[model samples]
Target chain A: MQYKDYYKILGVERGAGQDDIKKAYRRLARKYHPDVSKEPDAEEHFKEVGEAYEVLKDPEKRAAYDQLGSQWQTGEQFRPPPDWNAGYEYSGGFSGDDAAAYSDFFESLFGFAGRAKTGSTGAGFHAQGQDTHARILIDLEDAYRGATRSISLRHPQLDATGHVALRERQLNVNIPKGVYAGQHIRLKGQGESGMGDGQAGDLYLEIGFNPHSIYRVDGKDVYIDLPVTPWEAALGEQVTVPTPVGKVNMKIPPGSTQGKQMRLKGKGIPAKVAGDFYVVLQIAVPPADTDTARKAYETLKQAAGFNPRQHLEKQS
Target chain B: MKNHDSAPTLNGEVLEDYCLSLQQLCHGATAEPEFILQLVEYEVLVPQGGQEAEWRFRAEDLARLRRAQRLTRDFELDLSALALVMQLLDELMELRGSG
Candidate 1:
């Protein structure tokens, strides 16, 4: 067995406080949870993180691990000394279900089979199979108008010869309208095969949008930065703006301030539930290059005595 | 097996140039020749089979293989994880370029 550094795995220091350890574990657990995280190896990494937290969260287990000392490096061949855990009294009795879930190495050090005094009955006859989870990235436009995509997936198939073979299969999935990022869509009877006569579990597909070039998504609302000339912002004008659906004429209110947001009802991504589109005004100052343009800017700068920093001077 | 010593120097003008033979690449990667050959068998790596044993490798491909090897050996990341990382990185880069 290799020496595993539980503290390093959790990104916490060896002498960290109990509260800090608990906080870090909760944050990481939520991040790497199979349902939420997009990081690769989330499942395996999440398992390792959970196992590390399970041992570190308890003072008794932590003390036993610390006894191993700093001399043993990570991944080093390790075997616990005989009677190493001679005196520590464990407050909470060991649970076999947790032990079975953990690695054999962890089990050898602190395993307690038939220790649960409750004598809890195992999963009864109708045990639903564990749900399989996957995240699918879709185009932003697809959310506005629902789309059906044929996706290809590759899985390892165990043949009759016991050798693993690679197989490719296609699945047609219905992308619901108005599905936001981090939201999940459940596909019935598409998960891992069930044991015995049990029914198969569901496949949860978490939806994520491919970042858009012109738009940004914030929860249910969509925000777009629209650049307008200084004159257009000062004196209102009706201009065409592009949305996911199509281009529409939008009016800029007179004396519109820069960064002022305007809402267009039901113009954003049209999921089963619709969201509103927001346009943020950005006033662009024209750079004078030609002589006439320079003179025009000079006249405007002289006539329009708009001191942008008047408020700052007043405060001073 | 064409010796690495006998291989001519490439001027590096081309977008991608095959610098070393398949054997040299395997040895350089500290991987088995057969394991590298599996990529060729899968058409992941295109190699001309004959007495000359002509093998072509793009700079991008060489870099990807190096990264793949690092994920496997250094990080102990499994193959599925490596594939997912590659896909995610590609999508991220593509999104950035488009933006």
Candidate 2:
């Protein structure tokens, strides 16, 4: 395991006082907290900061850690000497339900004893397990046609000896059709198992959509940019457009401008209320590279005599 | 990684608006009824009903409550401050989404 420098993680001096350490932790927590922060990798940084605070906040843990000396650098190969913590006694074990979020270095030093204490229970004790939450990404097409997904989850579990270890479980889940983003799917009795005769907790999966090349989704509504030739926008014509379900012929009214939006009702996501599919027209102008194309453009310029900068000219 | 194709498929119930009861919300959030009641008093959660026993919450409430719990714990915020923070966060999310 690599040594993690708690002082470096919290950006404090090794000789810093408790008050200084606490203030630094609060500042970093505010900046890196997953729920509040917009920074990339905020969750990872937040976990590191939280772990640092967990050790630094407690006087016992801090003193015991200090005994290791400051000669070690972060990410350097590290192993505790035999009976490194023999003289120190920790009053309590690690707090929080997410001990698995900590690093191997942390678990190697402090995880086993504290976690074992919490995992142990008297005989015939029955308490329901804690519920679990996770987010799953599905394809936009899967939302329309309902697909089966195999998901793997890693969680902390206790062995027969009451030692906590990370375990992975896989489940094949059937995602129902018409599910939209921000929705939850509850799988009963699929979460953490109870200690004795208690029931297992439920698992809640929040649904999110993978970004699609041709489509953008907001709630249940879908949007796509449809490129059209200038003539198609200027003159009325029937054009084939792609929708989530399939391609359908849509009429482009005469004098349709660039960025004009057309709505196909009940064609977005196949939800209970059914969102609408929107097609925004993007006018693609052909370049006058060839002589014939240049001539055609010249003739159109002469015929139409349209001044697009009239408003700017009037303002000037 | 082991093959999971032979595993039986589990169908989950989609949690829609106003589909969760107070009891279920508590279990989903890992919170106590009194804490939920405090949230209701703070207007952080607006369940549909007159009494706490009869309240029905939206599925989204579970997520909202969890957020509230985390912010309160991390920041040592009171209910009033937490309520304000929640509203500001909602507005911030709206602005970001639209932009």
Candidate 3:
């Protein structure tokens, strides 16, 4: 296992006060919390921050971790010396239910015994297992046509001796058609197993769309920027617009300006109440690179006498 | 490790609008009924029916409820303040999506 420097992860000095450590944790947590943050790898960073705070916030754990010494660098191959935590006593069991979220180094030091004790030991105790949540990214095309997806989930299970181990399980799931972003697919009895005769919890898979090059989804509505020639926008034209289902010929209205949105009703995701597909017109101007092209542009400029900066001049 | 090729394809139901009961929502969110009730009192989550027993929640409500739980726990926010934050976050998401 690699040694994780909890102090360095939290961006505080090894000798920093508990109050200062807490302040740093709050600042980082606010910045990296996955729900609120837009940063890439926010979830990973948040988990690292959480694990660091878990150790440093508690005085006992902090003292025990400090004994590991500051000589060891972060990510260095490390093995805990026998009897490292001989004297210290942990006040409580592992704090969170998901012990698999923590790193191997942290688990090796303080995790095993605490987690083993958390498993239900009483003969008569029977309760439903906790439901688990996971987000899955699917293609927009998959929403149009239903598809099967293979997902790998890390499930924590207790052995016969009550030792918690993270077991990776692969499940093939049928994703229903018309599933949109923020929607959830509930797989019954796929979550944590219940104790004794109690029923297993359901697994809720939240659907998110992988970013597509040509499409942007807002709810069920899909938007695409279609490049149209200046003449095509000026004098209507029939253009083949690509949709999730297939390519369809769309009539571009005459006098269409740049950024003009044309709505195709019932053409978006195939929800019960179908959403509208919006085609935003982007007027593409041909470059006047050649002499003939330049001449044609010059003639049109002289003939039209059009100034696009009229609005700015009027405002000024 | 389980075999990937021979795994049975499990069919799942897509949770649609106003399909989840209060108990289902609570289980999905891993939150207490009291916490959900507090959320309702703060107007953070408004279900479909008048009575709590008859209430039906949307799939979106489950998502919102989870986010609410995380924000409240991390920031140690009160119900009223969390309600305000939730409203602002909803507006922010709307603006981002449209923009």
State the DockQ of every prediction: 0.01, 0.58, 0.60
Candidate 2 displacement at residue B29 in angstroms: 1.3
Model 3: residues >4 Å from true position, as ranges? A309-312, B1-3
Q: What value does DockQ give for candidate 1?
A: 0.01
Best by DockQ: 3
Candidate 1: residue pairs that collide: A144-A270, A177-A271, A177-A272, A178-A271
* Model 3 CA lDDT for position A22: 93
Ranking by DockQ: 3, 2, 1
Summarize candidate 2's per-residue lDDT along A1-316 as a digit string, tens digits: 8999999999999999999999999999899988899999999999999899889999989998998999999999999988888877776667756777889888878888788876768899999988898888999999999998988899988888787788988888889999998889999999889878999999999888888898988889999899999998998789998876789999999999988999999998988999999999999989999999999999999999999989999886
Per-residue lDDT tens digits for candidate 1, residues A4-92, read 78888888989998898888877886577543367788877777777787788889988987887878777888898988877765655
2 or 3, which is superior by DockQ? 3
Interface RMSD per candidate: 22.8, 2.5, 3.1
Report the C-alpha lDDT of model 3 over A1-316, residue by residue, as the tens digit: 8999999999999999999999999999989988788899998999899899989999999999999999999999999999999988887647755677788888788887677766756898888988888888889999999888888999867788776677988899888899899899999999888887889999999999999999999999999999999889989999999999899999998999999999999888988888889999999999999999999999989998999999899886
Q: Is the docking of candidate 3 incorrect, acceptable, medium or high quality?
A: medium
For each candidate in the order shown, give its overall lDDT on alpha carbons.
Answer: 0.65, 0.89, 0.89
iRMS, model 1 (angstroms): 22.8
